[model samples]
Target: MEERVKIIEERSLSEGWFNLKEVIYDYTWFNGRVQRQSREVAKKGNYAGILLYNKEKRTVILTRQFRMPSYLNDTSDGFIVEACAGMLDDDAPEECAKREALEETGFKVKNIEKAFEAYTSPGTLSELAHLYVGAYEDDMKVSKGGGADEDEDIEVLEISFTQALEMIKTGEIKDAKTIMLLQYAQINELLN
Candidate 1:
């Protein structure tokens, strides 16, 4: 096998974003170099969270909201079912996640467990997800959910483990970050 990438030049497209020029080496056929064939988006920053609550009950919380991308993609209500998450801007991953959990769903997490670091779309978008599994006893701490003024129309949904599972199976919870965290929680039996 030959390496498909051999960088010739790199250019910044935006802050924390870039484009790369490379060669496409094929072992079987031929080794050809392509010059700036296309834009390879390289993003540098955390852009997500996947929080888990009620570990004993095997349930997790998620959000239901109108997403413009989904709307353009033909979602019935343009709504995306996802875990509480947001972009991090010069904040610690854990703190950013905790703040997002509170602001998105109103759950003041007592503790947040780091799960894994992953990329949602590596081919184009460099959006990395700083995954976390957090727990909090549903109490008076979270009566006022988040409705931030960042081009977001979020609706919180505290669902049971069973409901979360069903939603996952039915394509209701389709976000990559949410799915990644949920899969870990389910496999580890930590979504109580």
Candidate 2:
């Protein structure tokens, strides 16, 4: 088969914390017809997320924070429960996950198990997320993590693994990365 997509033009629409571009391309159909298509894509780059679990306590450390996008969409207050995550920002995915874990949840994660990588929203966003699971203990608390400086206002929560799983069904845990990690823990019996 021949190459499917051919880029015609790409124009930047916005460039700030992230870049947004409008692209025109030619896509070859399965029937051998070429179709011109245009799409606007937001390029926020890749990120890493970690789910911190404590085997002895059968608990997980999570964070809740106000998310502008989620607030503008479906959430009334815009606060969401999610795993510790941050942009890779030139660092390795595992390192980013570890840093975010400590900065957002006060847990200094040491051994991270790479679970999987996924595109959060492939249709219009160019963000690939690296996922990880890390074991934590009570002694791992290193700081009163509420994010660094004035960049984030995060509330850390330590909840039982069973309750966290139940939150998934109750619509309390809506973040995709968090959901995936919780499911991974269940399937792998990480706490047991």
Candidate 3:
């Protein structure tokens, strides 16, 4: 299929936070017809996300913060409750997940299990998210995590597993990665 799509040209549109590029390409259809198409793609590095749970407590750790995109998209407030996640930076996926859990939720999680990988937004965003689920305990709390970055103002929340599921139904938890991870925990009986 590499021969089916040929990139004719790529122009950088923005290189600020992430990269945005305008690409012109030729697509050869299965019927032997070629069509030229143009699209704008956002190129950000891949990310790792983790749903921290405690089987004994039947609770999960989550984070809340303002999301500019969600605010622009008509959300009443930009704040979103989501699984702990961040760009992979230079670390491996599992390492990134563990690091993010600690940085965002104050949990130094051990016994983390790999959940799955998915493209967060394939149409425009170019980042594959590595998702995981982990067991956490009171002893895992090392600090009052609000994010390590100066730009991050994360509020950590620990809620019951059942309540988390209810939040999903109420649309209080709208982030895709968080919902997927929570559903995974429920389907797998991870908190039970």
Candidate 4:
């Protein structure tokens, strides 16, 4: 068996709206006998969230916003097309999803359903995403989307099930989370 690097020390690199940490890994994996005895060790985190669906309208709710990462990387839709999701700040996945939906869409979620939970980028970062679908009620749209403090310029989109599928096929919906939500809806017959 290959030896692995053991974390001996971890320091809070930064914490504010988000948290980052610096860690020390004992490089035993490299020091062990034979070059074959080596393995990588690291610390990571995940982005947990949920996806909302509206069975009554046969529509799915998505958010369109400028993504700095996508902009920098030259990815299409620097204005991203994604499911309503947010970072899980010490809360249960469903609770976080509900809070995010209300915050991002200014709409209330009813009969929220759990779709799935996944790692956005497991090999590199520890960003666990919780997927969810809630029945969307448009009659309850209150306030304008999201909070201003986060500097979030969000636009809400409501599309019929077929339209959503077309967007996905044409790569119009490029965000992974959004694609997953659409898939869940399709598989469950929440969408035609």
Note the Cα lDDT for every prediction shown.
Answer: 0.73, 0.93, 0.94, 0.72
Question: Candidate 4 at residue 154, lDDT?
Answer: 87
Per-prediction TM-score:
0.78, 0.97, 0.97, 0.77
lDDT (10s digit) by residue, model 1, range 74-146: 6557788888887788888888888888788877886778999987787866667889988767672565675
Off by over 4 Å in 4: 1-5, 8-46, 148-150
- Look at candidate 2 and give me any clashing residue pairs: none
Predicted candidate 3 versus true structure: per-residue lDDT over 28-117, tens digit per residue: 999989999999999999999999998899999999999998999885489999999999989999999999998999899878889999
Per-residue error (Å), model 2, residue 69: 0.7
Q: List residue ranges in candidate 1 displaced over 4 A.
A: 1-36, 40-44
TM-score-wise, the better of 2 and 4 is 2
Ranking by lDDT: 3, 2, 1, 4
Q: What is the number of residue pairs that collide in model 3?
A: 0
Pairs of residues at least 3 apart in sequence or in different chains that clash in candidate 4: 45-126, 45-127, 46-126, 46-127, 46-128, 47-127, 47-128, 49-130, 51-132
Q: What's every prediction's RMSD, in angstroms?
A: 4.3, 1.0, 1.1, 4.2
